[model samples]
Target: MNHKYIAFETIVIKEIRRFARIWLQTLVPPAMMIGLYFVIFGNLVGRRIGEMGGYQYMEFIVPGLIMMSVIQNSYSNVVSSFFSHKFQHSIEELLVSPVPNYVILCGFVAGGMARGLGVGIIVTLMSLFFVDLAIQNLAITIAVVLLTSIVFSLAGFINALFANSFDDISIVPTFVLTPLIYLGGVFYSVELLPPFWKFVSGLNPIFYMVNTFRYGILGTSDVDIVWAFLILLLFITLLYICCIVLLRRGTGLRS
Candidate 1:
């Protein structure tokens, strides 16, 4: 058990250092882009859009923008990092070693979480420059953010394992992530959508996550926040178990 923990710690440390070493690329650029969005969308455009859900448009969008950053960075970090290891054949070394598969999953997922949370913090501070940001509930907010990061990290790892080519990895973000995020109650309330479209949008998991986080911070949400957290927790648990099982079986690692 000691040996297992040591191995897990070593892999996690290596990944954290790898991402920290590339802070300029992985962390800073997202902060900059998000800052620009805050300037344009929240400052300039939001004024025209006016208040949303009894909050200033700028304030209302902050949580969604943060969640958006969390989701994208978390997913991209694991997919790119793990896929690089496999492409370079370094992952073969880890597989050949005695380290357990769950630890490997945790190590990679931790790296993604670190990078995602890092970017989220920076974006949160960046929001302070735009509006008087406030936390309506600290516990629920942090839990949702952490759970959302874990879910996406697991999803990214799955995507990496199944990626036959680099293009396959990008397809989900492009086709799935992008559309779902744009419609994830970021810019407008679901009530504003037509009845059929509202139901269609509800099917997007990102909606639950974004709304839940929004509820935590702004005290408003389109969906029940409890249901949102439960759905996210269910996905995280299922994804974690499935990922461990798949890795232990060398689903794509052997190839």
Candidate 2:
């Protein structure tokens, strides 16, 4: 038991250090890019647009943007880190060791969560410069962000398990994740969407995440909070199970 805990701790620390060592590449860039979004979208265009969802446009978008940072960083950190291990064949050593698959998975996910939540805190602080934020529901706010990060972190692990090359890792983020985020009610409310598009947005998993986070901040949401949480939990369960199964099967680890 102690050995498994030690292994888990070691892997988590290694993953954290790997990104911390490259702070310029991993951390600085996301903060800078999100800062740019605040400047362009929140400050400049937001003035002309005025209010959205009964709040100032800048305020309305802040939660979504923060959630966005968390999602992207969490997903990218795990996918890239795990894939690198696979690429260098170090993952095989870990797999062959006495470490349990669940420990390995949890370690990587925790590291990803660290990066994701770290960037989230940075971005939240940055958002303070653009608009005032008061937590409407502290528990809900924290819960959604944590769960959302875990979901993406697990997702990134799964992506890495199946990834054949560097190119394969980027494919899901570019073509799939980004599109979902934009359409997920980040910049605008689903209420503004026409009937058909509103129904379509309901199908997007990210839609629930963004809205739930928004609700946490603003005390308002387009979707029911209970249902949104259920969806997030569902994703986490499915992804975690999938990752464990893949690890046992040595999906991409076996050459």
Q: Among these predicted structures, which one has the highest TM-score?
A: 2
Q: Residues 158-182, candidate 1, lDDT per residue (tens digit)?
A: 9999887889889999999988999
What TM-scores do the predictions have? 0.96, 0.98
Q: What digit string (tens of lDDT, one per residue) describes model 2 on residues 1-255?
A: 599899999999999999999999899999999999999999999999999999999999999999999999999999999999989989877988999999999999999999999999999999999888998999999999999999999999999989989999999999999999999999999999999999999999999999999999999999999999999999999999999998888788875
For candidate 1, what is the TM-score? 0.96
Every candidate's CA RMSD: 1.3, 0.8
| Count of clashing pairs, candidate 1 | 0
- Which RMSD does model 1 reach against the true structure? 1.3
> Alpha carbon lDDT of residue 57, candidate 2?
94
lDDT of each: 0.90, 0.95
